[model samples]
Target: MIKFELKDLEVFYGDFQALKGIDMKIPANEITAFIGPSGCGKTTFLKCLNRMNDLVEGCRVYGQVTLDGEDIYNDYDVNLLRKRVGMVFQKPLPFKMSIYDNIAFGPRTHGIRSKSALDEIVEQSLTQATLWDEVKDRLNMDALSFSGGQQQRICIARALAVRPEVLLMDEPTSALDPISTGKIEEVVMELKKKYSIVIVTHNMQQAVRISDKTAFFLLGEVIEFGDTEKLFSVPKDKRTEEYITGRFG
Candidate 1:
């Protein structure tokens, strides 16, 4: 099933065109990686998934971006859109509160008021992000006490607390050590059974390792997209081959 479908999508930051007329389909229950040089609109397009770009001043999006066959930009409530499509960023940004509070924040915002209900969500989200065992006994401790990687997982748990259908990760492991990166990758692989995932990564090798499908972007356009193995072995576009082979970004 298709989770997200984009047609003739364009994004403009003031007078500068970030994403040109583009089209793509993101399948449900799979991981899709967007890879390219910096400023190639990989992150920009990721933001469009949940209308995060809407917060940017003078930012405008054109064309169609649908979630589960419904146009999210046309008539959906912005806040609810975010609840359905959660995001995890490059750096781990945990709220100053305890781990339990960080996970409970989303459920509370959505009107889930029962303490037991919040407790279940907190535990489940942390478990889903693969951080429960490490911090189960320290749920009341400040979230900032953990290392960078643990903090990222906490952010992921926070995102999952809202029961988002799609998870958008923008270089989520870029700041972590090798071991931490591996852990995040494993968690993401396990998550594909339930949530559609779109990841933006400058690390092509990481993309090849985890993503079921890969999309190569350049100058705000998708140059090629296909199964990870086939696309890497025999990319249809010269630019894709160049980027993958380290010939150029």
Candidate 2:
């Protein structure tokens, strides 16, 4: 099933075009990786899925972006849209609070006030992020005290706390060590069974390892988009071939 469909998508920051006309269909319950060089608009396109780009000053988007066949930019509630599409950033951004509170924050904001309910949510979210066992006994500990990898997992748990239908990760493990990166990858692999995941990564090998579908961006447009294995092995575009082979970004 298609989770998101984009046609003639374009984005501009002030007068500078950041993304040219682009088109792609993201499948449901699978990992879609956006790979490209710096400033290739991979992150820009990911933000468009949940209207995060709208937060940018002078950011303008033109074209059709639909979620579940409904135009997200047309008379949609931004807050509710965000609830359905949760985001995890490049860096671990845990609020200055305990681990339990971090996971409970989203559910609380959405009107889950019961202590028992919050308890279940916190446990489930942390478990989903694969941090439950390590932090279960210390749920009251400050989230920031954890290591970078644990902090990132906490952020993931926070995003999952809202029970989002889709998860958007922007270089989620870029700052973590290899072991940490592997853990995040493992969590993401499991998440695809329950959530449609879209990730923007500079790591081509990571893309090859996790994603079911891959989109290669260049300049301000998509050069190739298809099954992950095919796109990497038999790229239809020379630019994609060169970029993946490390000839030129």
**Which prediction has the highest lDDT against the true structure?**
2
lDDT values of the candidates? Answer: 0.95, 0.96
Question: Which pairs of residues collide in candidate 2?
Answer: none
Instruction: Report the lDDT tens digits of candidate 1 across residue range 1-249.
Output: 899999999999999999999999999999999999999999999999999998899999999999999999998998999999999999899999999999999999999999999999999999999999999999999999999999999999999999999999999999999999999999999999999999999898899899999999999999998899899999988888888999986
In terms of lDDT, the poorest run of 10 residues in model 2 is: 240-249
Give one clash count per candidate, in the order shown.
0, 0
Residue 51's lDDT within candidate 1 is 93
Give candidate 2 regions above 4 Å deviation. none
Q: Per-residue lDDT tens digits of candidate 2, residues 30-74?
A: 999999999999999999999999999999999999999989999
